[model samples]
Target chain A: MIRQTLRMARWEVIKLRRRWMPWVFLAFIVLSSQLRLLTEYQMYSNADPGRIAVQAGPANEEGEHSTISISCLDIRDGLVESRLSGIPTEFRQAALQEVESLRDRCPALLGMYDFARTNFLNNATLPGSLSYGINMFGTLGYLFVMILAAMAIGVEYTWGTARQVLAKGCGRGRFLAAKVLGLLAVVGIGHLAVILFMGISSLIITYTMAGTGISTDVMQWLRPGADVVKSMYMMLPYIILGTFFAVLTSSASSGIVISVVFYISESILRWIIGSYLGPDAARILISVNTPLWMASLEFPALNNLSEIYNYLRDFLSTFLPILAYIVVFWGGSFWLFKRRDLKPSTGV
Target chain B: MMASNDLVIKTESLTKRYGDILAVNDLSLEVPRGHVFGLLGPNGSGKTTTMGMLLGLVRPSAGRFSLFGGRKPHREALTRTGAIVEFPSFYPHLTGRDNLAFFQEISGNGDSVELDTLLEKVGLDGRGKDRFQTYSLGMKQRLGLAYVLLGDPDLLILDEPTNGMDPDGMAEVRELIRSLGDGERTVLLSSHLLHEVEQVCDSVAILSHGRLVVQGRVDELVRSLAGETILLRTTDNAKAIEILSKLNWVTDLNSKGESILVSAPTLRSSELSEVLSRSAVYVAEMTLGHVSLEEYYFKITDDANGDTA
Candidate 1:
């Protein structure tokens, strides 16, 4: 069985390598990442360093501060500002008042003010380089995982290769297993290639643009080595779930549709449940939280357990439905694929 | 008792239905090993369905079949059986060699020599590198045959193997199939061409409306038809007809431009010659023409309808 699986995997890899589409997708990911890094680097390097101060609070140190400074904006705030500008002024004013009240009660504001004052005097700015790397790696992980899953068995049907394979004495079980392994292998290789490409290019871009003499040790976080590995581990369940759908579906279109629906349904359900019910109920019903719970317990950082727990709780609470989706969709797809007939013609 | 190695295919009351239409009725037939067996049928016959079932592609509504002595489709059975049911399909984007390589891997047969030899046998030697999409229809058909020969299967089941081939391509495929049947391999070839079957097959089964109308050795079946047709050509064509017309055994007597044709149940040329000689008509030539297989096939299939009525 292992020998046969390897043979099938070899053939699948050959097929995938010969095709232009997979390579094109990989190239697109790398190119998009580089482009993003370039744009972000330009924006950061050209900014007036004196204007970029870390705002603390009134009594601490910073004499005066501009509201438009980049530090004042979290990612979510920037996104909301860009997207919700058309909303009526009354609603915006009400939301701003709520934020101000919360900020007034914060004890850390004084410390933030002190840091901002020192940083402004030193002419320092928060680098946007890491943001580009994160965006690129995250986007590739999402796209590659879904694309690989959608095409794994779906390509066989599209090309009529499934009929030829099945006719050669392969049962449904072995065939699906081979397909799942083959797809994961190809996705892995593609992911690794993109990681290498993005890592090297980002290093070059960061060194050339930022002119930061920071050693490799400090730049380790920006490197794709650890992050890509971690992201791939996180994506393993999704890839398996995606492959299940691809095999169960008769065509690529149906597989993609089913995968998207499964992914979306879980998030929607988790939201509805978490919003109306309690976090405990949401945790039980969702999957996103489970991984955070696992990660929190497994990986210890400089932060205390409470901090880790809080992060995990918040992360899992928001993402629980996705995990539920992975399990249910993967299980259902596996069941259907194991029973469906491998027909002689390529329907799609 | 059937010989252990004799029967290559045996189906028991195999039936397949599509909605209200019974595509394959409760049909059963046995194809003996080491013979070029022909499955003769008209359009919409169950030839394709039966082949599909044997190849493990179509599910039989009722009944089952054993391929290469196996009671059901098992790994052993599939390993020893090669089939081309209906139209052959291949990956349009890949080269013929790549396609064959993929099939070889799937079959798990380590014999590369056989692949090369089969490619040569199918007249697709160096062209294996060429993409299948670029191949002509005949080339595709040949490649399809090459695919079946991958594992050197014991039984070769082909459905209308020469469906769209030109005369030359048909002859090539026919010869290849014939060469494969050197008393070691069993070939179940289906075709609507009666003359082609008569030329190559040792045994035949005729199907009409999803039922076996008749089946047996080709020569015996042809010889056993109720009325025999004889074509006669003579110097005195006029005298030959007049003499033949007097015989009560002779039914229909028609004359071509130079020869006369007659259908008779029991009439010999000797008796006809003696009668013609007695009537002062000189018999220059007289011989009995054997009935062609096509006529025999029609006679038996037509008899089936009459018997039902």
Candidate 2:
């Protein structure tokens, strides 16, 4: 079984290499990340660092000061000017409580504010592109990995290759196992390639646009590395879940539709559950604790300010549920393939 | 009874059902070692479904089958049995060589020389490098045959192996199937073409609506249907016709041209000759017509369907 599965895995890799899916998805990520970095640089270039554009605020007699003004040069400086003490009494209490919560959660950023005062803001910073790319990685990576993984497995049934494989004496469970392993390999290799490409490209862009010296900040380094690993961990469940749907449904279109619907609807579902119910109740959803929850790593404030992560880390750091979801999806797929007859599938 | 090891496939009351539809029902059969066997049935007669069950692509709803003398189907047993059920399906993006190489690897026999030779045998040697999708249907079917021939399995099950082929292609495949029947290898060929099966197979099983209608040696099944008609060209045709018509065993007699066509229910040509010679009407030529597989197939299927005609 192991040998047969390895052979099937090799075949799947060869087939995947022959297709445009992985390379195209990887290229899209690299190109889009670089382009978005360029766009950020263009928008922030030659700005008056001291001028604070307050998009909204309460109307007051002393309008400019009543509306908070923070320098664009540093987020720390801007956040200080955003202190709740200056707010009107009506909104002051609520704002202070939120700020107090954020201050406690993001101790690293707040602690390093004094040291980061000399650094330039936005795209002028050396690690700006890398940070921005890592920020966008989770959501975009989720969509790409889910779509391609579903299509890869689902095409076997659509194209009738699954029947051929089983007819050749490879067991159905082994065949599905090979697909799961093959998907993991593709996901691992594709993600590694995307990270390396984006990292190197961001380095070049930062060196050319800003100066040569890069930030040595621990959080800056730790955040991207953590995000990269977390994004991979976050992607495995989606990949497995996508494949599960593809095998169950036996149609790429159905798999794509099901996965995309789940993805798009998860955030809405999380909101509805969290709003009416509570955050604890909402976290019961695997989707709530997975892509979106993991994607919150992209925004420092979102991860730090939300109490969901706090509650999550209490139970083996919230990995138990995600791991269980992966096992269920993968095991369900294996069972389905093993027991179900290999009918000539036309639609799904 | 033959030893169990000498039988390549044995199914005991094997059955398969899809929802309420019984695709294959209580099909018990034995394909002995070293003969080309034909599994003949019309469309939806469960030919492909039974093959699918044997190949482990479809699960039986009840009963069981053994491959290579084993009591249950397994990967190792199946590795020795190659098959192409229904249409030949392949990865269109890969080259034909790559497709065969993939199956060969999965089969784990890892005989590259055999793979090359099988490709050559299927007349796809030079064309193996072309993408499968680019190949025509005939080329694809040839490649499919090459795929089954890989690893040089002892048993081969082919379902409609000549589907979508021209006459020349069908003849080529028939020859190919016939050639696979060495004294040590068995071939179970499922087809709707009676003539092809008759030309190639030594033994055959006819299936109708998921049940085994009849199974035996090809010649035996044909012989069991009816005796052959004996045609004789005599110098004195009236005398020969009169003598043959008067015989008690001669069921029907017709005179045409300078010959007498005698439907001998059980008598041979020599017996007819004795009567003709005794009647002083010497036969210049005598030919005994063999019952064709086509005729026997229609007769049995019609009988199975309870058709009076």
Candidate 3:
């Protein structure tokens, strides 16, 4: 059985390698990531720290230079408050030591020093935007994975290969199992490629922008390794669900149609319910709700065990619906596929 | 001349239904070992359905069939049987060799020797590396036969194996099937072409509208019809017709100049000769007629007219 499974896997991999779609999707993801990174870099390039301080009010009362001085004072106070918040005592002390060293080296710009310290300290307490970007893109991976799964099974049926496979004495159960495993393996590889490309591209863009002296400390919030791992974990049930959808439908077009419709409906239902009935009721309607919540909860960083536990509670509450969906869809697909005649091209 | 241990396939009232239609109704047949058995039928005559049931690809609505000695299509039974139902389709992307190799693994036939010999036998020895999609219709048909022959199966069942092949290709397939019946293998092939079936089959079963109309040794079936037909040439053809007209056994009497052709009921050529000689008419030439399998098939299947023997 293991050998048979391995053989099927090998065949599936070969088929995927010969196909052009996976490569095309990978290229799209890479291009999209680069485009997003470039846009983000341009947005941050013109941002003025001085203007930001003036907009906070009372800085104009001090006149031009006095306003700079007042902004510098405000920056100092904000830094102190941020430093005293949740940071470890040792790290705070080290940070202060670094500030004193900077003061000694550049004594002429005390106002700028104070502002720098305040900005650094305040930003340290905030989650990075990079983490948010990773989390957002990670969620999108689920949809792409579904599309890949649909294409894997759908293409074979559309091309009339499933019938040829069945005619070889491979039982319907075995054949379906092979195709599912094949699709998952191919989709998994494609997902990894997208994740890797996005991770590398984002890192390069962040490094380049930071080299140009643009402060992008908030970019550290998106941890590539952690975000990818979490996203993949959340994508497991969705992959299974997508595969079931592909197997249940007779043609590729129908599978894609059904999966897209189902996913869109769930998203719309979740949005409507969340707006009207609160998050608790909304969570019960979306299959990916737990994953989304888990992803969001881990963003920035967990402050304490209690925060983590609360997030887990929310995730678990949302998980039951996804669990039920997976069970119904997977089991229903298996039953339907096993009994139905595999009229691949003739559209039975 | 039937061998005691000869029968390779035996079906008893085998029936199959597709919703309201009875596709194969109470089909009982016996195919002997080491003989090419032709399933002669037109479209929708249940030949493909019957082969499907025998190969365990289709479920019978009633009755039973056995391959070798097994009553059901067990793994052991299927191990010794290879079939190509309807149009033989394979993975078009895979090379013919790879396709055959895959079937070898599935059939659990590890003998590379058999595979090589069978490929060569079907004239597809070195062409196995070519992808199936690149192969012509004739090549695909031959490869289909090669796949079926992978395990050197005891019985080969093919439905319309030569359906789309040209005359030369059909002839080659006929020779290939005939070669399979040389010593051990029993081949059951279904075809709508009567001449093709006649060329290769030693025995044939004729099906009409889901029912078995006739079946037996091809020679016996043809000869049985032959015995009822006689051709006569006489110097006094008018006298011969006059004498033949008085007999109730003679029908379809045609007098062409000095020759009279008539289908006789039960009389042998020698008996007819003796009667004609006794009537004082010198029989110039007398010959026993042989009916082609096609003619015999038509005689049996056409609306039974008592006028034509």
Candidate 4:
């Protein structure tokens, strides 16, 4: 049984290698990472290193904003001028507080702005990319693997190849399991490809634009291993969910639609639930806990049983729901695949 | 010639139902080892459904089946069997060689399969490198045949294996199937094509409306159920019927449209002409031929329908 499943997995990889979908995603990620870098480079070059900048635009429109930079030397004068002008009365009090705050830490915003941009640019590099690339990966890996998982299962049904393989004594459950295994293997390879390509491109583009190799003093530099593992761990539910949709509908397009919709809608629901209903209400969802989990990857030394217990509690609280999602989707996939009759292509 | 009590495939009251509709009903069958067994049926006769249940592609609503003596669908039992249910399904983007290689690998026969050899055996060697999508339907069917022949499985279950093939391709497949049933292998072939099954199968089970209508050796069924019919035009139709009716060999005698239809063992048809001549029911025109599976199926269907007129 083990031998049959592994062989199925190997064949899955062979088929995946010949296909265009996963490679297309790899190219998309690698190229888009650079485009993001070039855009960031433009913004970095436009602002002086020690300038305080406010990004202002209509609230409804995002990515259509202009930065109003205030040099460190003119910080007080700019606040005073804005206050004395016919700004709203509410702005006068805010300006007064801001001016006082700046008096004590006038260069703080300048350093923060520079660090934020440079840290992001440094993501294209190795140790930096690991920490930073995981974030990039985290933001997009679900979509990447969601598509991968869907195609891996969905194509088998659509092409009528599932029956072809199953007829050869490969168990239905085993075949589906092998497909999931193969999808995960492809994702691992894709992650590496992203890292390698992102590193090389960022090095070239960052040096050419900013006159130095992408570098960062960011704390994430020390956590490459944790980042990669967590990024993959975090994507499990989405990957399984994608499989659920495909197996349930027996179509790749349906898997992609429902999974993508679930992703987008859940993010929106997280904000809505967090705001109107409260954090406790949002806590049950994957969207809320993923960031919480990502943010709390570090633990203070387990100096005592109390601290260790607390850490474990917090970890389980976040991890258990993800486990539940994996189980449910995984169960759903197997239930549908095993119980229902294998039919010919229902199309995309 | 390879007939035996050792069955390669046996189904005991095996049945399948989809909601209210029965797809395969109480289909108890035995395909003895080392014989090419044909499952003959019309469209929607549950042939594919039966094969699906055997292959574990479809679950049986009731009853059970065994492959190579195991009542359950164990890995070893399934591994010993290879099947094609319905049409040949393959990944369209993959070349023929890759598709076969993938299935062969999963079946645990990866290490030894010479894909090129299988392709050549199926007359698809040169085209094996092309994507499945590029192949014509006949080529695709040929590839499907190659897929099942992998690993030299002990039992081969093929459902309409020659579907969508041209005359040459069909003949090639029929010839291939005939050669494959060479005593060492058990083949359960399903087809609606009567002559094809009659030509290739050593024995057969005929099914209708999800029920086994009849089952026997092809020659035996044709000899008994598919009784020979001779169409004759005589100088005196009344006298011809009177003469043929006296002979025990003449199972049926009818007259219509200027011809006397005589049903009997057509091999003894020479006696028919001789007997008619002596009676002066002189044969003006005569033809003798044995009934094929094609006729027996229709007759059984007619008998089952029962006095529709």
Candidate 5:
């Protein structure tokens, strides 16, 4: 059975190799990185240092108007006047306080921006924009990867290739299992490409626009790397869900449609539940639970889990629900695929 | 001629029920080793359904079957068997050679240079690299035949193997199937093309409405029908018919033009010759014509349906 599964998995790899999916995936990531660089460059070149500079304004002292310089966060503090000026003043203090708590964060953003516009100005470091790029992947990359997963399984049925493979004595479960592994293998390689492409692009853009002043802080570099890991953990369930819907509907379009609908509906459902029942109660939903799990890792204050009696409670709350989602979608797809007959769909 | 132990496929009371409809009912069949066995039936006669069951695609509603002497269907039983059920299914985006390579890998039988050779065998030598969707229907059918020939499986189950083929392509597949039956492989093919089956199969089973109507060696079925018709041309046909009608085994005697048409259970031209010669009616010509499988197939199916009606 293992041998059969491995063989099926290898076939899946060949399928991706022979098709346009992997190339398309790579092209998409590169294009997205380029777009990010372009947007960052535009924002960097347009930045007016005067915005965050102390401005003399009419001050009311004893009901008399007098010129006084407003005190504000300074560029000398190694902060970008552009990104900071956009923050609403009412929340400016809070945001600054948060940034101050992570002292090494601002220089990286500022240096990344300056290096994006000037090649010799600053040296961009590793994991600079990869942290942000992976976050984007979770949304945009999620959709593309889901589409890939859907096609991986959907083509087998639509083309009647499932019958051909199954007729070779491959168990249904084994075939589906191989497809899932194949999808992961493709996604894994795609993720590595995204990281390398996005990471290097971020460095080049940062180094070109800024100067050779990027932080050598190992801890900050490690944070984005951790984010990549977390995003990967989150991606597995989506791939499995995509495969499940693909096999169930027997069409890649339907699988993509259903996955998007389910994802959006889960978010909507979480909102409705949270509005009526309370935020904690909304955590019962996977859409709420998964993001909240990531939040607990990124921002402990979001869920107040830091005050929980057991330190492991927050981890369990997040891990179990996502694990359950993986089990239901992945395991359920295997079961259905195995139990059903190898019937071909109406189209190729 | 192969022994029971040499049977490649054996089914006892194998049946399939789709809710209230019996798609295949009480099908008991034995395909001996080294013979090209044909599953003959008309549309909706359960030929494809039986093939589906044998290939483990359809779950039998009742009864059981064995592949390669095993009493139950299992993966190991299918490792040495290849099939094309219904139509030839392939990935439209992949080339024919890639499609075969894909299955070859999944079969865990390792790679062989036969991939291209099999394509050539099916008249797809130069076209192996073409995408499957670009091919005509006949080309697709040939590719499907080539796919089954992979790994040199012991038993080949093909359903309507020549359904979409042109005459040349059909003849090519017929020859390929015949060549595979060279005292080593067993092919269980199903088709509505009776003449094709007659030309290729050593033994055949005719099915109608999920029931086995008749099954035996093609020659035996034809020879069995041969004894029923005897044509005699004599000088005194009227007297000869009268005398032949008196025989215990003779029936359905009638006169047409100057000749007599008769149905007899035991037809021997020698006996009739002796009887006619002794009666002083010299016989000029006497022949026993055999029924073609086409005629025998329809006769039995029409009779069965007539009885049902």
Candidate 6:
């Protein structure tokens, strides 16, 4: 059975490679990663840092709002009058210290762009791109992986090849298991491509744009690597769900429709369940927990103890349910494939 | 009785039900080793259903079957068996050779040389590189044959394998099936084409309304089901019946509208006529006639239909 399954898996990858959809999906991911890197770098590079405007974000519950519209040069030159005038009274003192620090870094106008470039490099580079692409991979991988899983499983029944396979003594359970594993391999390779592509391209872009002062500790990647691992596992539930629907309905279209519908409807369902019920109810959703679990790692390690605590809470809550969904969907699919009589393909 | 070891397939009251419909009912059957066996049935007669059950595509609702004498184990038995239960289904995107290669590899015969040989055996050489979706129906059927021939399986089960093929393609497939079943291997063929079965099968089981109507060697069943008949117009019809009835080969002797119908081998028409003339019941007209498998099929199925009605 194991040998047969491996053969099936090897053939599955071969079949998928001969097709065009997976490559197109991977291309979209790789190109999108580069596009984002270029877009961010372009936004920062084109800015006139000498006269660039700065603004604070919206206020907290304590009404601590502050908006700074003064030019960077005004702050860089220690022109305290122009900078302090527009700032609100609640944030006036803290804003002064921040401007003073920037003034010290680029007290000369010639260094303002250099100073601003250094700040933007980290946001557009390897360590940042990992987190950035993790979110992107999860979102896009769910869609692509779900779509691929549907195609991989659905086409067997639609083409009546499942009959051919089972007739050849391939156990129905083994066939499905091999198929799911094959799909995971395809998606795994796709994710790896995105990670490598984004990492390489982001590094190249940062090294080209920053010129110098781009020192990143190797440890900075450890968190993003963990998130990457998390994002990869996150696509499993969708794969199983797609496989389940494909086998249950015995059509690729139903598999695709239902899986996509589920993928799309999940957020709405989570929102509805959460709104009328509560957030705890929403966190029960796999996709909902995924982003929260991913976002957990983004919480700073500084004096953000409570934020870290919430991150831990979401992480702990996220793991088991995602695993449970995977087990349920995969088990349901295997049972269906094993027990149900395999009819020839009815139609498209 | 054929030894149990000689039976490649044995079913004991095997049955399958889809809701209220009995797709296959108490199907007790055997296909002896190294014989081309025909499973003949009309549409919905459970021929394909029975094959499906044997090949593990459909689970039987009742009863049990053992493949290859149940000695080598189920999966191993299947590995030595090749089947095309319904139509030839394949990935439309794959080239014919690629599709063969895929199933070939999965069946554990990853030999490229064997795949090419099977493709050539099915007369699908050179055209094997074309995508399945682009191939004509005949080409697709040929590809299916190639796939089934992989692993050099000992037993081959084909259900309407020649469907969607031209007459020439049908003949080619028929010849291929006959060659595959030549002394060394067993072929369980299910086809609605009685003539194809007649030409290729060594033994057959005719199914009617999900029940076995009759089973025997093609020659025996065709001979016995509606025994060979001689239509005779004579000066003395009563005398002709009397004379022919006395012959040991004559199973039934009766008078029809204007002639005597003697149920005996049409091959012995000369002896029959000579017997009549010798008996002084001189024949004005005599013509040899016999029921073919087609005629026997309809006759038995109509009788089966009548029985249930």
lDDT of 4 by residue, A115-218 (tens): 75665556545466545555665666677778788878887788788887888878888888898878777777766776676667656665665445644555
Two-way lDDT contest, 3 vs 6, winner: 6
For candidate 5, lDDT tens digit of each residue in A262-301? 7788778888999999998987676676565555244344
- Residue A12, model 6: Cα distance from true site in angstroms: 1.3
- In candidate 5, stretches whose alpha carbon ends up further than 4 angstroms from where it belongs are A21-26, A37-125, A211-229, A293-311, B1-4, B71-73, B231-263, B266-286
Docking class of 2: medium
| Tens-place lDDT digits, model 3, residues A1-348 | 556655665677666665576667656655665566555444444333332211112225556321112222334445534533554554446545544444344434544544544443222222333343344434455666677667777765665556545544455566556666776676556556655555465455446543223244544434544655555555556666667777787666777777788788888888888889887787665454645644544432466777778777766665666667667766776787766545424421
- Give the TM-scores of the predictions, in the order they appear: 0.72, 0.78, 0.70, 0.83, 0.80, 0.82
The model with the greater lDDT, 2 or 4, is 4
Full ranking by DockQ: 6, 5, 4, 2, 1, 3
* Top-scoring candidate (DockQ): 6
Model 3, residue B260: C-alpha shift (Å): 8.8
Give candidate 4's whole-model lDDT. Answer: 0.78
- Candidate 1 regions with alpha-carbon error over 4 angstroms: A39-43, A46-49, A52-152, A205-249, A252-348, B71-73, B111-113, B226-264, B267-289, B305-309
DockQ each candidate and list the results. Answer: 0.39, 0.51, 0.17, 0.60, 0.60, 0.66
TM-score of chain B of each: 0.84, 0.81, 0.82, 0.84, 0.85, 0.84
Error of model 6, residue B187, in angstroms:
0.3
lDDT of every model, 2 decimals? 0.68, 0.76, 0.67, 0.78, 0.76, 0.81
Predicted complex 6: CAPRI docking category: medium
Q: Put down candidate 1 lDDT per residue, A1-348, tens digits, no spaces.
A: 788877887777777777776788777766776676555445444443222222222332666632323223332244435533554564556545544554443335434544544333222112223333433545345545666667766767776666656666766567766766676676667666655655576455445644343334544444434444545555656676667667777676677777677767767788888789865576654344534532323343656988788667666654555556566766776677654545555542
Error of 3 at A35 (Å): 4.3
* Model 2 CA deviation exceeding 4 Å by range: A43-47, A51-135, A209-212, A215-226, A291-317, A345-348, B71-73, B111-113, B228-264, B268-289, B307-309
Candidate 1's TM-score reads: 0.72
Query: TM-score, chain A, per candidate?
Result: 0.60, 0.67, 0.64, 0.74, 0.69, 0.74
Of 4 and 5, the candidate ahead on lDDT is 4
